[model samples]
Target: MAWIFALTIDPVAADSADADFADTFAVIDPAAPALSVGELSTQRGDGIFESIGVVDGHAQEVTAHLERLAHSARICDLPAPHLGQWRQAVEMAAAASGPGESVIKLILSRGVEHGPAPTAWVTVATASDFTAVRRDGIRVVTLDRGYALDVPARAPWLLLGAKTLSYAVNMAAIREAKRRGADDAIFTTSDGFVLEAPTASLILRRGDTFVTPAPNGGILHGTTQLSLFAHLEQRGYATAYETVPVADLSTADAAWLVSSVRLAAPITAVDRAAMPVDAELTASINEYLLSPRD
Candidate 1:
């Protein structure tokens, strides 16, 4: 069963510090109408969110996800979330999950136009089964993101690094990829540089080193990528972040699209070119990702 909680109190105010958060949030039916008709999250997609992967009822990497949420709030100019309160809310949401995998989303929306404060909520739902996608892998197409590699530094207003609700382009890219007979997409720069996937971070392997695009270039820093990189480093694998060239994709020994809920789905092909899939390494990565982590 799915669960939803509406945050009734201001999530960031200092006065709410000692207040009972149990009462601060109220359970709501997932099927019920909740947000105002004029809510900016729906009207303008003016919000930030984080989808945390929950395995076996434990919300993985809560602190990392919360920190990223705060980072997005800063980037989007949304109100900073109270970490303690949000942490409690995550605990509450995680408890609602049954056995197997689930997803808990933390959303902070700019409240109704000219309203009092920001609107916030937590939702928990069972995640889709990605077992086949993880094992069988996915075919990916390269779509130009229509920006030069230096756009983030040149245009800070783009808000590309923030995980906002404005995902129309991302979704559209995926649809376009499907239209081209592929499962997903890896966004590239207009000047021929590899960026990331529509919904996941791109990790490429060459020999013993694993590399991903530097997050400084308008890419939303991925929590799952970070954890997997750390796990790789611990397992004696070298990892680095660099500005990957588009031509390098074809030469990559292996590649995968890594995300919070989907975990890691190896890329079977890139633009109709068959790319090697490291099945043993892919399975090991997913095993580590599915393990309980704080």
Candidate 2:
């Protein structure tokens, strides 16, 4: 399928005469060159981003996603985003994308080397076909993240909790899992505590209690996970953030890899070890997740 890609740039960042606006917002062609050769984001991967799910012309959880983006920018020492401008940009892209399920990415990168300002843009594109994967579930494998659980607190320079543009290692980890014949990879500390998935958060259910690794352990605070937990709590399910051992996957009644795009995907197997699949629970959680909430 030919994906529809559109870029909405902040008008203040571009010369007024060089840009065009749709509803007072410019949507640039993806094929057009948009960045400088020395853009630090492309050069050294210095930036932060947010991928938000767009459903029926609405950006899901906009406030949470934007807040997290700001937090990440702070960690990277990048200038704070102009939220009004960003909202307009996102609105521009979402309007152009025409309400079909899509992924709206808000990106902020340090501009060209030694440049005075940052580069910001919004892109709306087709979301991946995770429907089948979400319904059928996936198999995952655990891999060592090499960092100890306490590294975030001790070595803040690592920017462990920030969602930076530097995701090559994350991409490679998933590729490694695919090479091993698994659908996804769950990262664990060398000391044996389950952290999170390459691009998602981990959730393990033992009976009625749902547990995941504490965010203080150097993992990004998952926006989807947080929302789902609120719904689960309202539905009378328990949730916790605790140190999860790798072995907990085997003992848990169910496990899920949750994220913005994938939502709640149940893990069918861990390290090729099969687990009980609760079609009922999966359906219920997904129903609640997909339902509109004010």
Return the top candidate by lDDT: 1
Q: How many backbone clashes does candidate 2 have?
A: 0
lDDT of 2 at 63: 80
TM-score of 2: 0.92
Clashing pairs in 2: none
lDDT tens digits, residues 171-219, model 2?
9999999999999999999888989998999988888988889998889
Candidate 2 residue runs with Cα over 4 Å from true position: 1-5, 11-25
Worst 10 residues of 2 by lDDT: 11-20
Error of 1 at 155 (Å): 0.8
lDDT of 1 at 126: 84
lDDT of 1 at 234: 97
Which pairs, if any, clash in model 1? none
TM-score of each candidate?
A: 0.96, 0.92
| lDDT at 274, model 1 | 99
